[model samples]
Target: MFHWLEKHPFFFAVGVFVTIAFAGLIEIVPNFAQASQPVIGTKPYTTLQLAGRHVYIKNSCNACHSQLIRPFKAETDRYGDYSLSGEYAFDRPFLWGSKRTGPDLHRVGNYRTTDWHENHMKDPVSVVPGSIMPGYPWLFENEADVETAYAEQLTVKNVFSVPYNTPLPMKDGSKVTVVLADTLSDAQASALEEAKLVAADMKDKSVQDAVAAGKIPEIVALIAYMNSLK
Candidate 1:
């Protein structure tokens, strides 16, 4: 066996290098190669979605849950549309992940009823019975507050390229509203507050609707991010 190994030393070295390179490369590429026939719809993450993603990162969820779905026959069948590159265009760090301690959460957005989510958030075992995952009671208990926090992050000033400081001219061109915080007036502050409230209300309604319908809230921006996973 030792003599055979020495004779094939070049092949062994090449194999080791190839394996390491492949492992590192997989972290960037979306698994579109394994996707079903036609590509699916996709979109970018909204500000709130981005914040939720940050939360996911802060919790180190990637350490245990893999976001990538392999292109194998069984994998494609189980995970829905295969992931694509354009799907994650808005992602800053990407979440292909490194392990699968839990099930693949590629299309998790589409799974489980809203109540199931609420229950799982309250106590995983209440829903999954034997789920090894820890319950996130805080997520449910502070639902409104957390949602408000998410909405606050989703404001256009934080996510889009609006000139918050440049003071956009109104349709009548009579007055100006600064885009940035350089010279925010009482009215501007009120408008911003209203916008935030609207966003929070939308998020709250989404969750309520999802619970009532026995489905998860699309959470507009969150839905945009999830559907983008292809």
Candidate 2:
């Protein structure tokens, strides 16, 4: 086979391409499989969180913030740990922003509380002095698209097998289950319940009223999404 192939330059090039392609596949396939698995303790987003994510996107939050934290001491000190692919297994169209105009928010949920996010979103300068970020007063007034978020949940659950409603392994050897609703009404109810919990920590009366009226405002959803970053 080698003697005949060496005699033909075109055939030799084709063989070389095939050999390289096979080697590339061999190297990539295993890592892709492992990286796509959910990291231990990495939970899927709840219904409200998904809605909040939509709010984040609609507001173009990704343009200023990044979700990825590099593996460096400076980055680790400021942000949290280095990012892992498995940790984003459940994130559909991950918010791994291309630039860091503000800061990495991959673990913002870990440090910031609901009240803090509420205050910050209302007025970024209120919480962080000299902040260039503008306030999002509109988020408190606008409604979130819970329907789209629910659709996303269903798609990821069915297509990616995200382990929704199934026990997922944790770092402490415990298993937690993330339930994806079977119906739109159920998803809406669950999202409202979650929004209420988030609203409980906020001091804004308007936001409180919105949740009371069975509505999920953009601010509520945005906070929920931020809180899920951890």
Candidate 3:
């Protein structure tokens, strides 16, 4: 068979291509699947965090910031650790931006606080001197679409099995369970409760008042989402 194939270059080339392709698939597929599983400590986003993710996408924050951190000295030094594929297992549509106009936020929740995000969203320059990013004053005024966020949670939970109610392991050897309310009203109430926690750390009166009134402003949701990045 080897001698016969050598006599015909076309067949030989085809045989070689098939052999290589099969070898590549065998080597790649299993590793890819394993790497794509959620990391030991990774958890699904809560209702408020998911709502904030909607706001983040709605405002095109992904256009300026990237969630991926490359395995490089400079990137790791600035953006915490390098990103792992398992870390994004729960993200329905990954936000690994192509270009970074601002900075990587995969670990921003570790370094940045609620108050810092509040001030930065209201006035970017106030928090970071000489920041070119524009203030998103409208986020503070607009009411967060909690209903829509809840709808997405249901879709992902039912269709994708995101494990919202399941207990997830953490790096510190603890477990955390993200609740996905069975009803829309319950979800909204839970989101409001989470928003109040974020509002407590913020100095913005309007944001605080809105959460107090049982209304979630976009800023609060956005902050919750931002804080969950870690």
Q: Which candidate achieves the best lDDT against the true structure? A: 3
Candidate 2: segments with Cα more than 4 A from true spot: none
How many residue pairs clash in each candidate at the backbone level? 6, 1, 0
What overall lDDT, based on C-alpha atoms, would model 2 receive against the true structure? 0.90
**lDDT for each residue of candidate 3 in 67-114, tens digit (9 for 90 to 100):** 999999999999898999999998979999999999999999999999
Candidate 1 on 131-228: residue-level lDDT in tens?
Answer: 89886544322222234333443354466543334443343545454322223243334333433432343434544453343332223223223333
Winner on TM-score (1 vs 2)? 2
lDDT (C-alpha) at residue 111 in model 1: 60
Extract clashing residue pairs from model 2.
Answer: 52-221
Query: Could you say which candidate leads in TM-score?
Result: 2
Using all chains and alpha carbons, the TM-scores for the candidates as numbered come to 0.49, 0.95, 0.91
Better of 2 and 3 by TM-score: 2
Model 1 spans with C-alpha error above 4 angstroms: 1-40, 141-230
Ranking by TM-score: 2, 3, 1
RMSD of each candidate relative to the true structure: 12.4, 1.4, 2.4
- Candidate 3: list runs displaced more than 4 Å: 1-21
lDDT of 2 by residue, 90-182 (tens): 787888999988988999998999999888888999889999999989998999999999999999888877788988888899998888998
Please list all clashing residue pairs in model 3, or write none if there are none.
Answer: none
